[model samples]
Target chain A: MRSRGAGTRTQLTKLEELLRELRVEEVMTRRLVSVSGDFTMAQVKELLRKHRISGVPVLEGEALVGVVSIEDVTRALEQGEMGAKVRDRMSREVITVFADEPAVEAVKRFAHTKVGRLPVLDRGGKVVGILTPGDPVGRAFRVMDLRYREQEQQRWQQKGLGLEDLLGEGASLVLRFRVQGEDFAGAGKASVQAKRVLGRLGLDPGAVRRATIAAYEAEMNLIIHTRGGELTLEATPHSVVVEAVDKGPGIVDVEQALQPGFSTAPEWVCEMGFGAGMGLNNIQSCADEFEIESEVGRGTRVRAVVHLSQSGRKDRLNR
Target chain B: MRLQDIKVQLEAEQVAGSPRPELEIKEACAADLMSDVLASARPGSLLLTGLTHPQAVRVAALASLAAVVFVQGKEPLRDTLVAAEESGLPLFVTQLSLFESCGRLYQAGLRG
Candidate 1:
């Protein structure tokens, strides 16, 4: 199925044309998770754990001085180095790539060094962004999706087919499936359908994976906890949204259920290897945007959106 | 280290899912506790555990782990294998104990 009505298709085509000239500055994460060199081990550990990141750059003034990673922290904790400063434990000889460099260069460095992230530097050699192993690939897939969509649009135009004619009269594809309570056999159907729709739309595989996982988790939650539910999958040119609406017995405590390892699921759900209480947490982590609302006797609603774009930065020229 | 190289270093065998030998193993977390894994596991890192259940695969999928290495020669059940396959999370089995497996990966520079 194919249709373009949101005008994101136009933006995507422009992105595709710009992709060939892509640079690290355009795709790198500008909001860097960096620490001061004078930060204590306790402080650094807290930062890393809070962000759920493996490593962080150490900055002394505007200069990129070092990197403190999980390995360094683990080694420090093991050897009673917990009280020392980050400068004392960080790898001083840091490897960095310039933001003006090509994205492929960053990919090669990540692949060769096996490093989880690299601090991106500006012309002044200051850390301006951080590039992870996934960033380049994410950008690449977004470019590919845009290119494919552009080509599909051109083909349809040449064939003189209207957008509705191509996608069965819709700006977005909506997939709805009824989820039966305790229906373990049918749990993943909605998720699978959502994934297929995303893939057919030529979204980035990582985005598809994340959306599929979130949808699967939400589907499982409805199947296990509620009496019955409806799973809705909505796919757009720029994003995919999945909403799981279930009939009561709504959650007594939504926040507690979002906590990892806090499950109210029965023994059978546990036996199936789910109900770890990680479902909601995982869904939130996987989604670019996530929300859950529940009332005691009313139903629960989970809505998650995974974007098909890279970096979520719409400004191409200024940045 | 690459996952295939890690497999070879540990003399492990691929039991289920896609064998992405070329995929890099940036960091690793060795644990049997799901809570710890969820709390500490970095995305694209390797997970070395003794837990051989479907939960293990589910955890790997949720955490976006690069791969799972089962220690102590244990094997995951059929349901776990199916989950791993469905999630596209690579699974490997090693005869070495959890401590030994972690030590080897650590010696080779796998964090934790």
Candidate 2:
């Protein structure tokens, strides 16, 4: 019994993690079927039967005033109070969940309150949707199934790849991203996308990490230095290549820029925890093969390649 | 150390995402610069920073950090919280300074 309890606990933890990744808005029913407070319980009974739902929220304008459930409808009919208004018959203490709150919160409320549904509200206290117990569970199961399939696909792909075959055929996968300069908020978006794509390709974990780091650095340089540029990631079975190309306001001295801790970034840039002069150095160290070329008036182009077989190599400076 | 232990060590208040107390945190990197965190922080390591910008959350997500702890009781900006929610990156705030937070975690046997 103790071991069984332990197993259940672990499973619950896993489920909880998945739930944390999801929001109430994602799992809740958005096509809300609601009736106004003035509607008769007889009317609510008809609405519930028409929608085949167990419950509906009673709204006063946009505000959720109460909940009228199937049980209430039955009681109203039995007590010969079918003509009573929903506002008087409905349960006023309606438990609610926030639309933006983690889905787990709704699960907790469901567990403790034993309610069939909870109206989901937005930050402004407006009813947006309703969450049923099955919604989160169904969503969690779907997400878990999807994740399992992805992992299986990654494993199958990884097993199918052979270095010789890849090199002989010269087949490669390519991904491209456009980076906008001075878009601090939008920075790192490309690298994150690249990292996910590489992971899905089933590359070596270390290789993926190195490639992601290099891609992020290159993406950053594009955002900080140029007006805009494009980042290209080309992947073969044996290697991952990251390239960043920008149009103008190029570097004057490529050698100086390559030096560690040498940054030409302004004070505002430094305060944001960037322009530490580590971008190029980071890319150089992560890549098994690194190259940089710039024409003073033209833009800079940096490329870094991480070999799959050399995934064991550590980031020298970082370690 | 588990995230629960680190939370206790720093007396952190989770501001975004749900807590995974069982989540293992083997290392941590403390830096305000997103670039530094990207260059050095290992995947699954915790990030300790004073920067509450959304970019900090983005950097943590991009770098695959386990979580982000904002030191000095600094609540993240609204956009940062939104980013955290979107990325599923757990965020915490501590009244402790960055130095003190790091010290507490180190004392609790969490390595950098």
Candidate 3:
């Protein structure tokens, strides 16, 4: 990625537009701190405390070796695991995001891939910066943007830009929102609330439907994973759009994450009422169009589109 | 027979519904989880269960369930029955257990 120090200024497109405007050369954290895969568990544990970071990127020469987080170290500690090295605990598979791409692509990547943090790379494919969902602004923007997007959709429907106007014509809308990751009890709350608002306003059932499904998944991602993120709902008279973004850990694998019954959540996530492993698959099953992007140390974003004119019946109420 | 008749037959009470003293009884099925009901409950089917919650009625509406009988002396709170009333789905609270509810209905000529 170019350095964030030298990038063109553009109109704020919410967080997503800013990402699109980003070139890999810009915004990459140049300072590099990492550990080798050969570092022992004992060494890694000491390094974690010394670095004051939750995890460290693993490097084999100039290549990404793996990521050794405190979580892994803790697991090892619990088992009294020693002798083995960072490679043993480090997550070998990584999710990477290109520096030249827009940030909006991170949502689907996270939800569908289920990895935390994405590694941004330059044109030559060298690691540049990290996108962790833990960033303060990143978390705040995710929550606020999701709220604003839901509210914006409500506003648009109020102005009579709902089904009656769009079913037969061409119209579009963009929404911004964030999914609060910390509230497990509030899973699917946004969908229920949005459903009520749409019902009261007499909005298009289709638009409300797509939004509700999208909202449920987006909300669940934050709740189950506890990684704050953003969700946007955009609508055209002929279609609807949803984008869920998370700066949390990037997904490990897009394909595997989207598969039904494939969950990386521990028993606690299930016991605490967090995961059914249905989040990513459900989103894909509902959206007419889907796209995802992620990096190992950075974050992930998802974009989904549904064409209104050609969109078939997605009767979510019956779902 | 009318739902009101079945309620009286089983000594059931109206917790939140309008009692639909006039609504008709059709068929019967029993399940507890919402997901199961969504996948298997049929239209116009009279549902028997011990589950109580808003989501129960929500799934009922989605599946077009005709009536719900809370068996084993189970009953929904005041607000839940009101939602059922608003949706126009007949709801009954029975003292009989789930199995007994099914048995009595079957003996009484309720099919399916």
Identify the candidate with maximal DockQ.
2
Candidate 2 lDDT by residue in tens digits, A76-104: 99999999998889999989999889999
Off by over 4 Å in 2: A1-168, A310-319, B17-19, B85-87
The positional error of residue A163 in candidate 2, measured at the CA in angstroms, is 8.5
Lowest summed lDDT across 10 adjacent residues in model 2 chain A is found at A310-319
Model 3: docking quality category? incorrect
lDDT score, candidate 3: 0.62
Error of 1 at B55 (Å): 5.0
What is the TM-score (0 to 1) of chain A in model 1? 0.48
The local lDDT score (0 to 100) that residue A260 gets in candidate 3 is: 67
lDDT of 3 by residue, A33-135 (tens): 6788889988888877886767778888878867878889889888989667888788888887776665555544566786666677767877766665543
Q: Which candidate achieves the best lDDT against the true structure?
A: 2
DockQ for every prediction shown: 0.03, 0.37, 0.02
Worst ten-residue run, lDDT, model 1 chain B? B33-42
For model 1 chain A, the run of ten residues with the poorest summed lDDT: A310-319
**Predictions in order: lDDT:** 0.75, 0.83, 0.62
Better of 2 and 3 by TM-score: 2
